[model samples]
Target: MVGYSALMERAEEATYAGFERLKRDLIEPSLSRHEGRLIKTTGDGALAEFASPLAAVRCAVEIQDGLISGRHGFKMRIGINLGDVIVGTDGELFGDGINIAVRLEGLADQGGILISEKVLNEVEGKLDVGFEDRGEQQLKNIARPVRAYAVRSGADSPLTERIGVAPALPDKLSIAVLPFQNMSGDPEQEYFADGMVEEITTALSRFKWLFVIARNSSFTFKGKAIDIKDVGRRLGVRYVLEGSVRKASGKVRIAGQLIDAVTDAHVWADTFERDLSDIFLLQDEITTAVVGAILPKMLRAQIVTATRRRPENLTAYDLQLRAMYQYSLATRKGLAEAIRLANRALELDPRFGFVAALASLFHMVKVILGFATDPQFDRKEAIRFLRWASSVDDGDPQTLATTAMVSAFMVGDYESSIEMIDRAVALNPNSHWVWLDRGWVYHTAGVPEEAIRSFELAMRMSPLDPMLDRLCVGMGMALIELSRFDEAIAAGKKALRHNPSFSATYWCLASAFAHLGRGAEAREAAARLLELDPAFTISAWIARGGQSNAQLAIEGLRKAGLPE
Candidate 1:
């Protein structure tokens, strides 16, 4: 977590509302844009977590830069560190990770970020910031020695011109592709090597999450035996790709290496041997392999750096993480456990809108799947929680999207639901949840084509998303409404592969298979659905705002031998 504290004591003494405006109006949006989760906030400062050290530092820089140039009247000091943490049953954080960061915050100069050595090592050359290495010092109550570094924002770095005056690193994982060495000795083969570099760069740029440096800037290092650390500093990239291409005796060989320029760590290295026939084909093959290899390595590194290993002392964030795991199980037991964990998280921080929304989702799922003991209570509580979430943080796209779905499905307020969901989409078109919820809204509105398009778009945004099964189930339902039974069957099967226990997946399969008159398969799916959700009933579902094209699913389930 990054701890940021305002420098002005008068700012804290001002009206509480005025201080909150600075956080709500200025600081928080920057955090959201960088995928940081705000854990808590006092009148003068806040604590937040990012997926990686790079994101934490970047967000810190953005906050400081905004304070200097924007209307915000005060500067802030930020401290960041990486370490193991414990998750409490109630939502709160504890461990050296939290303690060290807060102490370091007090040590930072106004408008600058101070990072522990652990953070510096993970993000040194990856960012354009200069580091003033502060030697190891003993922190209060900390048993071990800790080294800290002052992260010089681009404003303080001499290389700021090469890095541009952006003042912050790119939000996504950024990379630079140096010119591939022409090792074949034939001057004519230089074109092939250059073509490989160009092709690899172009292919990698297709992923929206990747920021690829332009070919012109990358090619500047082509012939020189340059230090990649310097290259990373110059380009403001986290990873650098360098390779060599060789051709002889009708055979082509390509070797590529991906480096974490900050720590100078070799992340991934590979070599490929292929036939020289059809030069373009060989180039395409090598390009695909190199890009494929680098992406996974990058993802693994980011995930590992972003999240610390869970410890025995659980914080609110850790509790939420645990709840999400239970929720993914989508079983009766899992739903109960998920609800318990979510409620505990809310108890710890009643103002935590994200957790309130998640708990509401658990209740809504119970109501929809006929698992709730008090269906009416669950329905009303879900809407109440969602409304509270909206009141707390209306700018949160996920909360808005979830609120929209609850409004439509539980409150039967379609007009307000559509309005809220549209607002969410406008706020964040890149959010997969926003698209998925929009798909559901469209499905309930009987717009099958629009629903399919929204689902497909969600899949495109997050091809390997953990919630892929849910997306597939939604798409299968939409396909069934379109009378595309074959496609629906395929989608349902794919959903099952991802999450066999997801009741919706079985229901979708049963409906699709029954529509296709595959009686045996339909019966099998129906049995599986009943096993997971014994209380499920087509008539009950229809009674609870499951009208419109959903009748298609109800009719199919009836044919598959489910009770009316």
Candidate 2:
């Protein structure tokens, strides 16, 4: 009940009489009608429970409507939450569930009812009343912020007005970073929280593969309680990042979670605690950590989604995702499937430069693995696709990086490949793909030390990347070039652990072991390599032209008794 004390001061006797009459005539009857049990009552307000959230909300609306229509001198405020409650010995309700409802009632508008997100989720579509998002509330005695919604009873409601048709999602991965909640209990720290979001948004925008919602568009939901699916629809994004920031004593903590907006599934989450010494540096560190962590997760999620879709329903982007997944398998059959998918994607969207670059990479891989039946045909196709990709979208960092690899391995244009990869790094240095491609380009150009450094940096950037096998293989080949045979063998073993089926791992191990005079191990590795790729030969590998920069590896392969 609202204004109870004020009404009592105006007319204590009449107020007390009216309260009793109203409780008997309206509140208790409405509660019974809706299957609600009145647990207990404070002087002005009451606590109640219901078996169904829908019944509880309907009862709240009925009571509020009765108060308004019957001209009750005072109005009541209500809050509803749905969760397990601790039943006391004396039949009193207790728990965070009850506490949250109490806090929500206190925060509710004078005559309005507020409901927790859990309750709203249960009662939203079933109820006639519309809900106005009250945003995330820092409830008293609550450890985490609770998202609340205000129930509005009328035909013309914000829910009806705001929830229109959703826009279609973009072809590439899309994301929106909602403003972080300030749990610092100080208004001044709001700027720090906002700054953290801005830094993350800026860093994520660097990845050309991601379509990030503009700050202005994302900021529109800053202080409103958001439905992840609704926000995803409105923003046309796949992922949403939301979090809270807390500053206490001499340190600050930033907690973040990545959600698949469409499914409302949590993909990734982490908390970073840092000293309050340098605000800007802290923002940068947090941003780097967040962006690096979520990129691989988003990719994995996308791949899974693409894999589940029917072949007939695949779009150009879906084909690209499938192709990438195939490429990650690192096998001759996987390479062939990747090329087929890439070509299909090109037919769907001829101007998809990323797919064009991917096609070039597939062909280059075929040549490298000696899988190409016609070496010259594969070489020509690789060059053609690279040229088309560069002409179509030279600005895309991923496309540029992939084309750079083809330029070095297929065309033997070391200078141009180096320049292209340098440009790609300048464009998106945070991208592990760019760094990985840069490593391969440098290795093919015979800069073994620089290749190792680039590969190591890539490993640091995406420590959990599924494609770590490729990085280790590059590092192993570079180690062999430096005559660090033992280190090369170790790198090969690690690569094998990441992907035992990868034929290149055996090639790396065979070369390293043979160079170290470990003939038995070398022969064993050579046998595994032949089992994986029966057509593999020293002549075909050299004829591919990329091995000019890897002469030591070629010599070691011959020493291991591989077919010449």
Candidate 3:
């Protein structure tokens, strides 16, 4: 009832029917099975009081199984109130535990289940399911925030998603910074200590020639057992930052050690403890000590050991060197950091076309990822950067090509994205991303064949990556849009084979079935799509990130009976 928007997206008619059927068949029987009571059901969501939080969870798991096995397109999200819920004027309850349950439900996946920490502690060792601690979430309108965790949907837990699993570093310097221990006894204020290490790892990522292991990779060590030299060898980084935070009622204490992996030497070490309020300033000192101290030295050593004696014809590749560095960071954090550094670099030299071009590269992804709250504003920023780069340096092919791609793909001037990619390809035959971006543009334009060829070129240049997977998803959906069902299914299967966990592949599969008139398979594929992403409506998709390029897939799915 509370999550109608989510239910209706899966199925407008079946969602309702499934609700009634579940009430009559599974729910009423479950209450009898567990000696429980039926609290109430509004429309799409349900709220209930349980005799035991233990019974409440068992009922929830069974409810999910019934809906999925029954082929009901609608998925229900469950929340349970273990304590009192005082009736309100509007006929809703207002109490601490009940209020917490409502928020806990919102955190759950649309058709998946989420439970409060209170429920978790009560049901601990009694249930067979696993949990992923979501941490102490700051929510709206709660006096004491609850600690939340996500329950695995079934006996099996979902694999935590990480990008591009670090292949054998083969001399790659990938590393993670474990959360420094807050030996400070007061667990309530460890945010300051934890946040400092994350920023330093982020700064290390800026070294483009280096492969800084991702933040998520490093944070897995927030508070656990680890050997320093072993961690460095495992993470493939030559150095590690291990530290502890200690605080007393009157003072603070901090200590850290950076060890060289191969030599096992303490290359850099420092300790600083100050009043809690000065923690932010103290962090900068730690960062400067680690970054300004050790990373550059490691990079210099790696450079000495690298196969290539020096940059190949550095005189001719100056723009390539600088532009490539800018392109490495396409995420929001990376983009913002890139913009800051790019701006500072520009200030040092007003005619820094290369930096401006890099700014455009970073901003374009920023626009794609919904990084800025105002889409048009960031789009303007992207355009401004590209335009400035183009105006100043007509000879820089990197600037010209990036300018063109941003123009066509993001701004809806398809001609320009294609033109720039073409020009860039002419200038530097080895730029793999240029080809990939071109393929992305054509795929957006609903030109499947051209997109496929460009993607093929990109894949040829960088064969190890799963870029083919994206191409397959885009082209397969395009094929379905063109009413080529068999080909679409074939390509979709290929995509899944490469990355079975990818959700987009299911979207591609559903498109093929919808176009082929296999309503049963189409419905199943749609269910799979929902399983992958419950909030996957076209409108939300566009809002989350500009999917102006996937309009054809959206149209096909909408026509193929995707619920509004």
TM-score of 1: 0.55
Q: Estimate each model's TM-score.
A: 0.55, 0.68, 0.37
lDDT of 2 at 39: 84
**Candidate 2 pairs with clashing backbones:** 135-225
The parts of candidate 3 lying over 4 Å away from their true place are 1-355, 369-372, 466-474, 477-481, 485-510, 517-536, 540-551, 559-564
Error of 3 at 67 (Å): 78
Q: Candidate 3 residues 368-442, lDDT tens each?
A: 544566667777888888888876554444466657666765577777667766776665444445566666667
Candidate 1 regions exceeding 4 Å error are: 1-312, 544-549
Q: lDDT for each of the candidates?
A: 0.76, 0.86, 0.61
Can you write out model 1's per-residue Cα lDDT over 1-564, one digit (the tens) per residue?
122233243344453555575675456555754557677776567887776787787667766665555554556788899988765654467788989998888788877778999998898787666899888868888999889998774554332242253333353577889999999999999999999987787666544345666565577687998998888877778799999999999999999999997789999888989998998877766775677557756755654543354545555555666677677677778889888887887887676677788887888888877778888888888878887787555657777887787777777777787888889877655566688898888787777798899898777656666667888988999898888989999999888888887888887889889988999999999998888888778877776564545878878998999988
TM-score for candidate 2, residues paired by index: 0.68
Sort all candidates by TM-score, best to worst: 2, 1, 3
